[model samples]
Target: MRELTFENVTVRFGSRRRGTVAVDDVSLRVPAGQVVGLVGESGSGKSTLARAAVGLAPLASGRISPAPHERHVQMVFQDPYSALDPRMSVGESIAEAGRRAVDVAGLLELVGLPGDRAGDRPHLLSGGQRQRVALARALAGDPEVIIADEITSALDVSIQGAVLNVVRELQRRMNLTMLFISHNLAVVRYVSDIVAVMKDGRIVEYGPVDEVLGDPRHEYTRELLAAVPRPAH
Candidate 1:
């Protein structure tokens, strides 16, 4: 069965002075337990599409069918610091997953955070720690799908690896269907089984990661590959 899908989705916003179509007509699907990377430059409707997939963004036209409640879609934002609350300590923030808001020490441990760090606020924790907490909170709902929108962009190289590993493990262990949205090609390639490239608010090219990344068919996709900086071994 299909885990998540967007059919001919269109999102348009008409403000007081102007109107814009953030997400053009887009249709996508991710099978259960597969990770599909939505690769695009900023404003290419990556986040907008991510939100739409999870029913956060109202679809102006077309259809969005989320799986049943037990198989609901979940989102993981890019900025862990911004996504988390400063008023609550890391433990308290994670504890929100509980029905009555009990301690989340076990949750912290699951995300690789020390139990002692539970009392620290977002400001005190490192970029990686905050993200771990975010992961714990998002998983608190026990979602079937997790939308990670450039969640590691704000972290250091070392921290990026840590967060990505956690996501990868969770996907494997839980058989999660995920939409990993990012501007970073390397990161996308690392986590995705398949990739779809978006341009001008539409997916112009898509295929298996090896095929798309190894031999890009689209001009924009080739350009994206060329712009990537490689490290000399």
Candidate 2:
């Protein structure tokens, strides 16, 4: 079952980044029950493509289709700082997910946070905490698929491992179809079963993660692989 499909999608933005296109005539299908990593440089349009898939951004051309019946869909943003309401108590916020037909407590636990963590506010929590809260909210909707847009970008290195592991474990336990977008090839390789490389807004290469990451055919992809900055711990 194809969970999401971007058919001949094109999106362009009037930006100062020369030769940069958001997404250019890219066609992609993320199959059901797998994680797909969308990778590119800062302006590679990976995020733009993800946003379009989730109906957050409109396409300049082409079609975006969600899974049939759409049990639910969630987005875990890269920047946890701006994704949530500072004033809203996590419990209140999560409880609101009741509107999405999910149980708030179950959502919190599913993200690996204690159910009580739901009562805290974004500002009261650490960076990882905030991100988990956001995840809980996203899951609160009991989504069948999630569009994770750099959801771990703000966490500490140690925390990143924990969160990544949580996501990996949950994906299997719950059968989630994940679209993980990032600039880091390492993270992409870690979480993705399939990989898609975007360059100047177009999908230059795509295939199984090991195949594309281990044997990249595009110069841009090789350059991206080479430029990955290792963490200084």
Candidate 3:
């Protein structure tokens, strides 16, 4: 188990004077073998942070330990349809990211996908299945840290739980360190050991999952909690 850390991380787009700061001096940690959920509304820099971790976004300042070149990190993107290649079979895609002689079937099974589905192309799978395939590919690389960036947002509500279950189960079974990013407080509460609330480009509140959710200190967090759908008796 490897702990992932961000030290005063920042990200910007376009020119320095004219560019917008997507993430601002954000420092958070995902402890080894634990899940840290990053929750915020859209345009809150949640996705940008994830992208920076995976080296997809250029960092203007600060550092992310276990850099992408070290191959200790892998990211599962939000859009399942676009995450995988249209031309490659799911198995091939997994193999492409994996070290030599990867067990494509086993990785599929790890994500609750059948071994036989390996031959299916991205178009042949349902949205949930494609997301599962993406998860499998991430695992094939044997990453120490996994960044799940709003992975369930694009899926049907009925299937979101299924995907989340796979994620939580895998994290526990593998003792994986993960950063689970989402806008849904309920979803974050369901899977996180710790929670960080972001508004604008900075984290406004962060603490243990139950503490932060049950007794939020930040006004933004309270508003987000209020927006959550309460169960009907």
Candidate 4:
């Protein structure tokens, strides 16, 4: 597994003079073979950072180590339906992103999907299954690091757990280094070893998931934790 690093990275949009900064001088790391969860509310720059990591969003300044190359870093986008082509069968999509001599069936089975479902089109699968296909496609690239941007936010609550289970299992089985971005604290807490809380366009607090969530030092982190709904006794 390879580690991902961001050094004072900044991403801007539009003209330099008038453009807004989507990610502002942010620095973080996803250690090799570890899951780093990035949590923040809407427009907090979490997704922008993920995009910048994958070379989708251009950076105005600073640098990202190992560079933004598709072979090393792959992203599993939130909306699998839109991410995959409607005309292409599941096998074709995975093969397209993968290197030569790819195991399309094995990749499908790895994500808990049947090997025979390769011929099925994206529209025929449920939201959760499409997301699994997306995961398989990402794995086909043989990437050391994966940037999952709110991957489960688009799915139904009942199906969310199943997809997340696949992710957790894959991470353990493959020792995949990941940047799991989500707005849900519970989900982050469940999957992440380290947690980073972002507010506005910067990370305000970051540490081990237990420490950061259990005893938050930053006000924003505390507020986010407090916002999680608790079950009645």
lDDT of 4 by residue, 86-120 (tens): 99999999999987778999999999999999999
What lDDT is obtained when candidate 4 is compared to the true structure? 0.94
TM-score of each: 0.90, 0.89, 0.98, 0.98
Q: After superposition, how far is residue 114 of candidate 3 from its true place, in Å?
A: 1.1
lDDT of 3 by residue, 80-119 (tens): 9999999999999999998778999999999999899999
Q: State the TM-score for model 3.
A: 0.98
Number of the predicted model whose lDDT against the real structure is largest: 3
Displacement of residue 74 (Cα, Å) in model 3 is 0.3
Which parts of model 4 have CA positions greater than 4 angstroms off? Answer: none
Candidate 4: clashing pairs of residues: none
Report the poorest 10 consecutive residues by lDDT, candidate 2.
Answer: 64-73
